[model samples]
Target: MAVLGCYINMVHPVQAERRKALDRFKEQIRYARDFGCGIIGTETGNVHAEIIYTEENFKEQPYLDVVESVRELVTEAEKFGVIVGIEGGVNHPIHSPIVMKRLLDCVDSNNLQVIFDPVNYLTPENYMNQDVIIKQAFELFGDRIVILHAKDFVIENNEKKEVPVGKGLLNYNAVLPFIKTNKPYINILLEETKEPDIIDSIAFLKRIYYQTV
Candidate 1:
């Protein structure tokens, strides 16, 4: 289950650049099988072309822009028999579980699915409440989830900071049990990890992933 990381800013502020980005994404879709990959994964992007955090991303227009962008990508993916895996984050337009659910509904294409990253959703203010948020995500779109991005985060100076899977505060217990039960053998791609940490992260995930329910 190889997934090509074709990450790009789908909602680029400039129309010309946005079209070019989409064209490049479609090209990846066309050549996905050549790389022995059936899924092309990306984060639903920010309104800023620079990919920085902005309050504008939370507005309606950016959300609609992401919907249109994903629809276009899904159309190209459908032709190539590839899956378009969209990921959401705090900085992007499709920022929350409810927003992601709406995007999934509006796109309404079988080719469009999710690459869920639980750590990406955590904020300093909401980190303590992640159990509820993660559970809501599974309840809302567990069936649509195609991949999982594993990482951990900690709060430093009242801001969220990313770290390797087992080195920080992300509760894999909230995630792995659901994967074991519903999405057996699903790919859990690790991010924000380094050498010694990567090995420990994989071992950590395997331990929880194989735990009895």
Candidate 2:
């Protein structure tokens, strides 16, 4: 069964009520572990701006605040004995896979892992580089990929958009081969599930996916 690792903000920035969010985050991770959810991932940081890539005053990418926030998540994740994968998305400056690499290298925490979503690194001008992007991601993250945001993406009118797994620019069939070669142990977590129904998502992956016979 696909475990829903809630991507919604687990940590509310009500600095006064720090324990509230921390306690909730702990409960969710413990829930994941109790249910045998092999891995879970989430964004440890965000910007207040409405725009996806727009830089904010204090919450810029590689924000020190993010590191501090992750430290808290790390402490909670230890009890569940689950690996917490820190993701790089449009809302973050750690947009590239290499930034994920840098964070892993810097903190050197055994409890943290990578949630590879290669298309998040795509810029307007560099939209045609999914092949390069995915390859670079595999090279950088390698076996540390704990989970995959298994959805392809596109830039339409400069806004990021999600298309189906096999139909869009994601090249899921080929992409999975590379990911399997580099990080076979990691689960291909489905994200960007554009289908309105959960059943639709299962149909999509059943048609084109990485599996062993």
- Of candidate 2, the 10-residue stretch with the lowest lDDT total is 49-58
Residue 26 lDDT, candidate 1, scale 0-100: 95
What digit string (tens of lDDT, one per residue) describes model 1 on residues 87-190?
99899998999999999999999999999999878899999999999999999899999999998988999999888888899999999999989999789888
TM per prediction: 0.98, 0.77
Model 1 regions lying over 4 Å from their true place: none
Deviation from native of the Cα of residue 180 in model 2, angstroms = 2.4
Distance from true position, residue 203, model 1, in Å? 1.1
Model 2 per-residue lDDT tens digits across residues 72-171: 7777778778777777865574656766677677666788887777666676677677678777877887677777777766778986677766556666
- Candidate with top TM-score is 1
Error of 1 at 115 (Å): 0.2
lDDT of each: 0.91, 0.64
